[model samples]
Every structure is written in C-alpha cells, then in structure tokens.
Target chain A: MRNRQQGRVIVGFLAAPVILYTVFVASPYVQAFYIALTDWRGLSAEVEVIGLANFAELSGDPVFWKALLNNLVLLVTLPVVTIGVALFLAFMLNAAGGPRSGEIRGVRGAGFYRVVYFFPYILSIAIIGVLWTNIYNPINGLLNGALRAVGLGGIQPSWLGDEKLAFWAVLAVLVWNGVGFYVVLFTAGIKAIPASMLEAAVLDGASRSQIFFRITIPLIWENIRTATVYLGIAALDAFAVVQIMTGGGPNDSTQVGSFYLYQNAFSYGRFGYASAMGVVLFVVTLALSAFTLRATRKERIEF
Target chain B: MTTATHDRVSPQAAAVGPRRSRSARAGSSGPTIVVAQAFLVLWAVVSTVPLLWAVISSFKSDPEIVADPWSLPKALRWENFARAWDAASIGTYFGNTVLVVGGGVALTLLLSAMAAYVFARFDFRLKGALYYFFVAGMTFPVFMALVPLFFVVQNLGLGNSLPGLVLVYTAYSLPFSMFFLVAFFRTLPGEIAEAATLDGCGEVAIFFKIMLPMARPGLISVGIFNFIGQWNQYLIPLVLVSDDSKFVLSQGLANLAVEQGYAGDRSGLFAGLTIAMVPILVVYALLQGRIQAGMTAGALK
Candidate 1:
C-alpha cells in the first residue's frame, strides 16, 4: 500500500511539469535543428529541405558576421571590465575598511552602497533602454546637457546615432547594468573568508594591495569563475538592449547575433534562415560555456 | 614560501603587531579611502541620476525640457502622467502585465515546487535522468527555441492570448526554479516527513501539509526571483503577444516610445516610463534585502 501511494504521488507531481517542459522548452530546442534545414517562410504548410544551404548563406552574410563580431567583442570585454570593477568595489566594501583594532571590517555604510549599486539590475531592460536613449540624445539628453553644463559641449557627440560610438554606448550600458550584481556576489564571497586567515595576513605585515591580490582573489576564485560564465552568457544574448536602444544600428554597426536572428525571423519572415542562425548560436553558446569552464579551472583551494 | 618565511621570522608572536602597524596603515588607507569614496560617490550618482532625471523630466513640458534639460520643472505637471495613463493606455498595459506576471509566477512556483519536491525526496526509477533533463534546460539560451516555439504556441491556438503567454512563461521558468528549489528541498530534513507518514498521512498529504510549509523560505526566494523575471520579461511577450491591448508593460512602453517619435508627447512618454518603473522601485525599496539575497542566491553555487 505504501509503495503504491508513493507511485501515485510521484506520477501526479511529475505529469504537468513534464508535459509543459516537453511541449514548450524541450521540444522547441530539438525542433530548431530540424527546422534549420528547411526553407520554411512560415506563411505556408510547405517546407523544402535544402541541406547545408542555410549554413552556407550564413558564412557569406556580412551583417550576420558583423553581429557575431560584436557579440565576440562583448563576450571578451564585458566579463573583464565588469568583474574587474566589481572585484575592486567588493574588496573595498568587505575588506578595505580602515582596519579597526586588527579586525578587518567593511567600509562605512557597505549595505547602503550595495543597495544603491544594485538598483539598475532590478529595472526592466526595456526601461533601461528607453532611459539611456533619451540620455544619449544629442540635443536635449542629460548626458550632453551635463557635458554642456560643465562647458564641455564640444565633445558632446550623438551617442546612439554615431556608428563608431553606438556599439560602445550599448556596451557601457550592459556593463553598468551588470556590475552591481557582481558587486553583491563578490562581497558575499569575500565575507565567507574566515576572519582568522585575514587577520593572520594582517599580522604578517601584508599591505592592503598585498592582502587584496594575495588573499582575497584566490579565495573568491570560484565565485569569479561562476561570474565569468554568467556574464559570458549574458554578453552572447544582448538582444533586448540592442533592439530597444539601437534597433541593430545607425548602420548595422551595433548588431549582435540574437537581435539579428530576431530581425530575420520576425521582421524579414525568413524562419528557416533564422533557425540556421539559431543553430549556429547554439553551437557557439555550448562551445563558449565549455571553453569558459575549462579555461577558468583552478586547483580548488579548500577553506 | 611567503607563509613559511613569515612563520620562521615571527615564531607565532605577532598578535600585537597589527596595533603597531595601525598608524602606518592609517597613513596609507586614509588617502586611498578618500579616493575610493569619491569613486563610489561618482558611481552612485551615475547609477541613480538618470533615473531621477527621468522622474523629474516627466513633470516638465516639452518646451521647458528642450530649452534646458537640466532645469527643474517650473511646475509639477500631473497631466503628463494622466496623458500617459489614459491617452497612451499605460493603465491597460499595466493591468495586463500584472495579470500575466501574476498567473505566470503562481503557476511557475506551484509546478516547480511539485517537481522539485519529488526530485529532492523520492528515490524512483529514472530520477537522476529526469532531474538532469529539467536542469539541463538552464544551460542553453532561449532564442534557439524561439522560431519553433512560436509555431508551437500558434499551433496550440495560444497566439496573442494572455493565458498562452502565462503557460509559456511557466515553461521557460521551470529550469531555474527546479535547479534552485531542488537544492533547497534537499536541505530540508526528512524526519518530519517520516513522522507525518507514520501518523496516517497520505503521501501527497505529507508533502502538502508538512514539507510544503517547511519549504516556505525557499519558495519565497524563488517566488520573488520569478516575479521579477516574469514582470520584466520582454523578449517572450514581444514574440508571443502583438495586440496593443494585451501587451505587457515593457512591450507597451517600448511601443509608446516608438509611437512618440513625431507626435511630441515626450513628457507623456517619460511619464509612461515612470509609471512602469514606480511599482518595481517601490517593491525593491521595501524588499531590497530579500530581493538581493534571492537574486544572488543562484550565483553562489
């Protein structure tokens, strides 16, 4: 009787979720591969399979290449810059407090600083895009307004309209939106370090920089690695920000892969061609995840 | 090598050394702290000033805004918000968003908790395989599934409907919820479950009456995370629902900004942005601690 009841409970609990996952998440993922081979415009029931045709076109698609290149630039730069700034801020917040009588405590109002920094992460990406677009407006935006207020009007360029500045402009927003979460993340990692270890280093006449470089980073390396992977994934799928802010550009200059795929599928109605792009992104995402995990591997340092 | 040399030189007699170095450390960190504080202040300003500017600019007329963006509003124009809410249909979009996100988060939590509970507690056939199947969904980006998923939803006749969007949101959210909550359920003690079972409790009853209540904190954390995610969701709603009346706030606000290009309701547009932002801001302020913890919890693993 007990075994029978257990079976009933298990089956009951798993059924809905199983169906939902299979129908929505799992099936779509599997079908994307099959869909990539066909020239299905999605307006008709007919799908003509053209083997390796979509991939061939993708290689020759210059706009797609530009998009991928932008993603690559973001993947490299976003993690390094965000992590570097966050580490500095986290160390300062958790350990850079003027040491009071041998115990290394965080700075004054660390909680306040954290709350302030993390505000952007909670806002909708759409809200951020809208807000930043206005801020970067050449004539009446706050960025230029501030620049002019400070008598630097000559350098106030149209941020989103200029092809050269647009991609970097979007990237800066990504970094801005991302840094706070890592700050809170790294702060937690730093707080986990046993007080005795830090005190020992302090007693041994380690400078602040010495303590940060030698003690803090190595202990939080796992957190850093986790952060790198998450940020890398985010950098790959920067669709909403690019779409809302630049709409793939002043001249396709700020195009990223995910947004480009979105454009091809929805705007252009080339479902088969877009699916091929999706498949390529799938491979790149897998490869990047694997490469990041392997590249950031360090000998585990037990606390 | 540094540890060895330090140990050899000190012979474990450096307890008082920090006090001696206090003045020297202060001399160095004093200047550094000032610079660091300066940078932190600058960043805080950078983080918040734009948002404040938006809120402030929402109260200014177009002429005032264009003439001097930096100047304070001559008078608070509550009409801008009125225009955004009524004329631009932000109110409708806000209601739709609340409905969809509410349904989505509720369904996600219930289904994820059920699946997670079993994975955490039961030892069944294919259990490892099943758990990993759900967990594996978290690794891939969602855009890969978009084209096919669009067809799948439309085939099910869910296109442009709120319930359809809710179901899709629940499906997408399951992976992370399962990953987070499975670990959460494993940490729960099994003794209460066993005791409840011995007390003539049905297997389902034991789970609902005893274990579910016990997992409140985990549920709350995952619930908040899901709430924020579904609330701020853009790409899915952008794809699934195209009707203006049915659009979520993010999609609707994006539409509003685009529509305002030459229509010159700039202040109204800012008002709509402010309207969409206020609830999130208020909630974040109220539950900043819990929200921060919940959001960052997934990264700790």
Candidate 2:
C-alpha cells in the first residue's frame, strides 16, 4: 500500500523543481501579462499601470511591423529551403547507398559524411553569426574575393551593407548553419526504414525520385514535422543571429521580434512596450508551433 | 552464391573502373552518384571553410589576412592569441563561462531529473497538468519573457551576478531538460522499482539507488546539451549581467565585436573567436555521435 512516507517523498522530489520552475520560468510568463499593463522602466518602484497603451502603440509601430515581417520571411523561407535540401542530402547519403541487405551496405564513408554534415550544429549560433560576418565582409571577405576571382566582379555586392540584399544575406547564413543539422537528422530517420521496403520499390521499377516521394518522405514525416516545428520556433526568435550579425541590420530590414523585444527593454528602457511585443511574439510562436503540428499531422505509418 | 561472387568482384570494379562503371559502387546511376558526391562535398566544404578561416585567420597578421583571406598565414602571429586572451580579456571571459555553465548544467540536471522522475512514475491528480506546464515551456520564447524577468531578477536584488545567471539558466533550461529527460525515465522499465519497493526500499532510495543510476546515459546527454546551451546563452546574460568582468564568453565575444570593435586588431578578433570556439569543438569532435544521439533523440520519438 502507498504510505504517508512515500507521499512525502513524492512531494519532496517534486517541490524544489516545481517551485523553482514556476518562480523562474512560469512566473515570468504570467507576470509578463500583468507587467505589460504597467509602464515600468525595468525597476520595481515608481511604476504606473497603463492599460493597452503599449499594445495600441505597437499595432502602429513600423519597426515592430518590420521585425514581424522579417520573422515571417524566415518562417517561410528557412524551413522550406533547409528541409528540401536536407531531404535531398539525406536521401543521397542514406538511400542512394544501394541495398543494405544486398552485396553492399550504406554509402561509402557514410559515417564520415554524417560527421561533416553535422559539424555546424555544434557551433554556437553567435559564433556562426561572427563567422558569417567576416565571410560577408565586402572588401576582404571570402565570398566577394571568390566572386572577383571568377571574373564576375560585376555581380559582387556588399552583402551585409546592401539594403536590397541584407535580409537575404542573413537568411543565407541561417540556412547554411541550419541545413546540416536537418541533413543529419533526416539521415538518421531515413536510415531507420527497413531496407527491404526500398529494395522492393526499386525492383518494382520505381525510380529514385518516385521512391523518394512515395515511400521515404511519408515514412519520415514524423522527423520532418518535428524538424519543422523546431525550425519555425527558431525562425520566430532570431535574436542571437540578428543581434550579432547586423544588430537588426541596415535600416531595420532584418530585426526579428525577439531582438526587438530585447532592444526595447534593455536599450531603449521601454519595458511596457517591449512586454506588449513580447506578448505578440509569444502568440506568434504559439500559433506557429500549433500550425506546424497541425499541418504536418497525418496518419502515422508504422513500419 | 552469385550474390557473394558479385560482392567479391564489385569492390575491385569500384576501385579500378572509371566513373563510367562506378555504379558497381552502389548500383546507382554513374553521373548521379558523382553529382551527388560532388554536391555533398561542396556542402561539407561550405560548412567547414568558415570555421577553418576563423581558425587559420587567427594566426595571421591583419595585413596578411586582408591581403588574402583564403591564403595560409605567413607569420605565426601568436601575439594575436596572447593579445586577445590577455589584452582583450577573453581568458577572463572564458573562465567566467566555465563557472556559470558548469553551475547551470549541474543544477539544471539535478532539478530536471528529480522532476522528471516524478512525472514519469507518479500519477498524482495534477501530474498531467504539471508535466504539460513544463512541456509548454518549450514553445514560449525566453526573451519574450525577458522584460518581466528583468524586473523579477532586479527585485530579487541579484542583478549582475554569476549566481543569478546560473539560477536563471537553470530555470529556463528546465523545460527542455525535463522534456528530454521524462522520455528517458519513461523508457526505463518500472519493474525494478516495484521490486526494490517490495523489498522495503523506500521511494527516495528506490529512485536514487535504483532508477537514478539507470538514467545515467540520459543524464550525461542532457548535461552536455544544457552545458552547450548555457555556454552559448547571450541574451539572458547580456541583459541581466552588465558587469564587464563577469561576462560570459558569448557576451564577451559580442562585447569585443560590437562594443570595442575588436580593439582594431582583426587578428586578435579571430584569436578571441578561436579561443571561444576550440574547447567546444574539441569536446564535440570527441563525442560527436553521443551529442547528436542525445540532442536528436526527441525527433525520433
């Protein structure tokens, strides 16, 4: 029989974490709602409550809108570009290795290839931001230097400085940093499919692309779905990237919601307004995650 | 067996024959395999080259780097690293990062594992709601809550301190740490606990002496994950801890880049970047497989 001591143990085990989690993580979340209504300059004292003014002002603020639009762009582009390329590379690494049960196994150096693909995932995003900053340097960077060497200097542009191209430049670095992770991820997922299934599809006269779309894609839907949600969440909060890379960029073309929220609270001392934006960011993240889970939800095909 | 004989002959064919007969390698199309190989190679190069440049550029003089960003260093300007480590105070930042990340990871794992054990094994009335409460922590952006969190941390009178950063790190890390760990605890068979309990071992003993030991792999993986995440944390420390001497590595690196403009020594900048990156890179290189397994275990689930 479950006794009083056991109940005491359960409470003790759960108490600290639950309380700490609530105090540190959950309380801030709930507190943000209340604090959003107040005009606090990051201090506890001398704060007056302002009802919906921050939200009202936020609705018309163009910088907040620009940041939201940039996040929208990342949400749309980063996932599609990253997932598409990851699927291809994963298939190329895993499926194109011919038959597992046949004479040969996976692709040659498959392990090595995976390590290479996964290398970028370990680096800090801030580090990635710094590395790309140097690479995108107009005068002495690798990109423009290589472009000039190819004798097509006319097309070379100041990557981070060009207003027309700054957003795309940031997105390019994000894609480059992100694609390798998904490639390794989908590779693991694709590798789990029984080889006989794929070999049968091949013997049945199915082409590579056909087998990919019909068989492999459906099988790895779970991974794709999870990856999509994570990527979408990441896209919604492009704080470290934008903060390090361009600091919201030339003319605010690449300011994301999280970074904007940060700048308002820390830089401009506008806690109330920032909390309003924070609320919106939270809602968008919630909606984005919900949308991904729903959009990618399908009948799970057990192997 | 024809298959066996074909296997024997295939390697020789793959090695000796040109690209025209390279299908013997994997039975895929010749040019397709070649193209795919080329594409993957290209991608790998793209991924590695930036880091490589960062490392190599660390050793070069600024003029040499500017002259040929692609070329190898002519002078082994070890001064750059020295200047960055001492002059730019990267060494101090690195030590600070070590302390905070270490504290954060240890506390996060302890709190998460304890909470996860309850969520995994217990069936209390609010268990479902409480677990979902932590799970929902995964979705909300941490910075979105920063405005209020600032007030909370400031009001607690723990501003600009390493311990405060550690507490914040542990708190924010709870959600994912708990989520990842609850799955691990669930996978562990319950019969052992039942047996231990039946033998008169108490609940705490059963968990500590029985279940916690079994959850080591999960703990290690989660530890490494939380360590990396806490180390890379920029926004939290950037906003909360403003003291220059107490800055974490990422925050310090940002200071070097954004605040001081790398003190006008480009090579020192690369040196600081290299110093910041190398330790993690080494650990990652050693435990690449394990890290990936632990980090992506959820995707598979």
Candidate 3:
C-alpha cells in the first residue's frame, strides 16, 4: 500500500510536464506531419489531402536543394573548425596556468580574453549580421578599406554580392561568434584533469607535446564529442544569421534549410511544402544526433 | 655485477633527469612565453575588431561612416541612439522582449524543474521510456513544427500575443531545460526530500522547500540559457506575430536595418544594433561567472 502510494505521488508530480509536453511539443510534430500531406495554405476552411505531392515538390525544389547544400556546408565547416579551435585555445589557456606563474606575460589577460572572446556569442544574430554587413561592404566597408590601405584596392570585391564568396563570408562571422562557447566548454574540461597526471607524465620523461596529445587530448574525448554534437545540431538549425545577413540572397547561394523552411511557410505561404521540408530536417537532425551518441559512447576513463 | 646493473639503471635515470629538467625549464621560459602572448593578443584583437568597429561606426556621421568606416569617429553622434530608439519604437520592443523572455524563463523553470524532480525522485513502470520521451523532444527541430505551431496558436486565438509567444518559447525550451535539470536534480541527495517527507511535509511542499532550493544553481543556469534563447528568438516571432507593435527586438532591429538600407545611415543601424545587444551583454556580464561555473559543473559531471 505504501509503495503504491509513493508511485501515485510520483505520477502526480510527472503529470503536468508530460501533459504539457504532449500538448505543446509532441502534438505539433504529429500535426506537422499530417499537414505535410495536405494542400493547406496556412489558413483555409477547405483542405485537400494530396498524399506525397508536397514531398514530390520538395524533391524538385531548387531552393530546397540550395538550402540543403548550405546546411551541409555549415555542418562540414562549423563543427570541425569551431570545436578544434576551441580545444586548441583551451589547451593553450590551461597550459599557461594562473597569473601567479608570471612565466607567460600575457597570462594576466586570460580573464579579459575569455570575456572578450565570449562577447559576440551573447549578441543577437541580427546585430552580428548587421555588423558583418558593414565589414563586408564593398564600397566603403572595413575590408575594402583595409585592402586600400594595403595597396590592394584593385582586388576589392563585393563580399555579400559575390555568389562564390558570400556563403563563406557569412560562415566566417558564424564561426567567429561560435568558437567562444566551446572554448569555455573545453577549458572546463582541461582544468578538471588531475595535477598528479601531469606530474607523473613529467616524471616519466614525457615531453610537453607527447603529454598534450597522448594524455590531455585523450582525456577530453567526451568534451570534444559533446562539442561536435552541439555544433552539428547548430549547423542543422542555423537560420537567424543567414536570414538576417543575406536573407538567403545573392542568387540564393546562402540559402540554408531552416531559412528556406521559414521563407516557404511564412513568406511564400507554402505551408504544406514547408512542412515536408521540416520533416526532412527533423529526420536528418535525429539521425545525426543518434550517430553522435553512438560514436561518442565509450568507457569513462577514471583518473 | 648486481651492483653494476643497479649503477647502470641509476646512471641512465640520472643522466636523463637533468636534461628533461633543463628542457622543461627552458620550455617554461622566454621564447615560448612570447609566442603564447603574441597568439592570445592577436586572437583578442581579431575577436574585438567587429564590436569595436560597430561602436565606433555608430558614433560617426552618415557620410563619415560611409567614407571612412574603419576610422575613428570624427565626431561622436550621440543623437543616433535617440534617433534609432524613436525610429524603431525600441522602447515598446524592449518591453515586449522582457515580457516574453521573462515569462518564458519563469514558465520553463517552473515546469521543467517539476518534471525533472519527478524523473529524478520517482521510479515507476516505463520510467526510462518516459525520460527518453522528453529527451526525444530535443531532436525535433523548431522549424519542423513551425507550421502546425502557427496553426495551433491561431486556432487558440493567441497569435501575435505575448502570452502566445511565451507558450511557444516555453514549449520549445522545455526539452533541453528539462534534460539539464534532470541531470542536476538526480545528482541531489534524496535523503533531504526523504527527511522532509518524514517531517510530515507533502510532496509539493518537499519539492518547494527542499528540492527547489537545492536545485537553485541548476535552475539559474537553465533560466539564463532560456533567457538568452527566448530573447534572441527570431523565426517564431516572425511567423506568429505580424503586428509591428508586438515585434521583439530582433525583428524590430532587422526591420530598422532594412528600412535604413545598406547605404542608409549605418550610424542609426549600428546604434540600434548596439541597443539590441546591450541587455544580453549586460546579463552575460552580470552572470558570466555563474554561467561559467554552472557550465563547468554540468559538463565536468
């Protein structure tokens, strides 16, 4: 009787969240999947169930492919560079030690460096896009100005205007803004390593390089894995930055999947087609997440 | 001969030890130190340049901004801030942002924490499945549900309202928030709650008095994260809210920037961007240590 009573209390505690989740999160997904099969124009009394027509349209939609490609590019570039650079910088920060070392003169500025590096991550993407737009402005922007300063005025090119460089340019801004968070993640990971391990490494005649690669790097695999999965999800869900900066423009070279989905649903009012695309994105994200979890699953190393 | 073998081993160790020390000492000394300093300084400058450029450009006249975008402001145009504020109706937008973000954070923490507590404290049939059910919600991309969510909001007659946005934001953030909080709550000792129960407290009271206070750090961490997420939310508001009066800072700023045009006075745009960024920056600056400490705690676990 007491055990049953305890179970009831637990169920009562869980009821609100489960109901809320079902209503808000899970229900919408089922609804979206249903809507994808119909000719729903976002608002209308009459709705037609067109079967796989929406998915059919998606298969041929040029913009959809463009957006998918953009997402792919983001997935490729962001996770590797952001996580790698962050881990590298974190390793550097950890090795430098606190200011008491005084061996590295710049170590005093570590706190300031951390804050400054993280500053951009806090700002809205709209601001980041606007800031970068000015930086990339062909005529009077900073990049062109620097080029002029360096006597390379003739090579000044339109950053957002050029089809080839526009995506890469926007990506640079995304990368610059994103690295700080993972840096913090990896820094925390690095700091948690036991001092005794390093002392033992020293005692074993291991050089600094060998210690870093073999010991520190191997130890922080979990952090690296977490950072990778985060960056992957972020890449898949990227919308604000592209939407704000290019609006997926310059001949749609910068069109990302999420932005495209937004455009379809809200701008073009192709609700059904957008729903199909959304489902595709959802599946891809799920698969990637599953893959990450599987790949990163390993026996935890005890220190 | 045995002594000779010992001497051989000892001498090998002795010979390698000083060389290692010498290199270690040199490695910790001047040249590498200079290199590390140079690298950090370069990275710092690279990171700060865009922000500095934005701030400085905001102070320049329109013509000057266009003519010399990278130069020091010839004169500080403090009026740009006021102009942008008025033009964008930033005051209204700021209020709306506070309402949505604030409500969203509160609701998220309240609901997710309760759920997290239940998941942590109670075990029942399909408990693992129930927990994973919530975890699965994290994988559902926001864009996927945008269409139905829009319809759901419209059907409920809550579209374009602060309450509507709050509902959507809360729903969206719940999965991750719950995930983090569950881990945190699970780490809490069950003995406290058990003791509270033994003291004749009800489950609700035990949660409120004991578990809630214990989960403060986790709640704060999740709260700050949700605050940032909701504050910076763009697409949800874009789809759900059509009224300019109800626009959040992101949409408001974007409209202001577009209206101002690329050639349009960037001073006002930059000023507006700066205004948009201030609250987030302030929150970050205020809670940075907590944020770092919380993240470290969460990750290192």
DockQ values for all predictions? 0.47, 0.46, 0.35
By summed lDDT, the worst window of 10 consecutive residues in model 2 chain A runs over A97-106
lDDT of 3 by residue, B1-34 (tens): 2354344334434444545443445434334444
Candidates 1 and 2 compared: the better one by lDDT is: 1
Model 3: residue B233 alpha-carbon error in angstroms? 1.7
Question: After superposition, which runs of candidate 1 have C-alpha atoms over 4 Å from their true positions?
Answer: A99-101, B1-25
Q: Taking the tens digit of each residue's C-alpha lDDT, what string does model 3 give over A174-198?
A: 8888888877888777777887677
Given the true complex, what DockQ would model 3 score? 0.35
lDDT of 2 at B221: 89
Ranking by DockQ: 1, 2, 3
**For candidate 1, what is the lDDT?**
0.89
Instruction: Please give the lDDT score at residue B81 for candidate 2.
Output: 92
Residues B167-244 of candidate 1 have per-residue lDDT tens digits of 999999998888788999999999989888888889888888888898899999999999999999999999999989
| Residue pairs in collision within model 1 | none
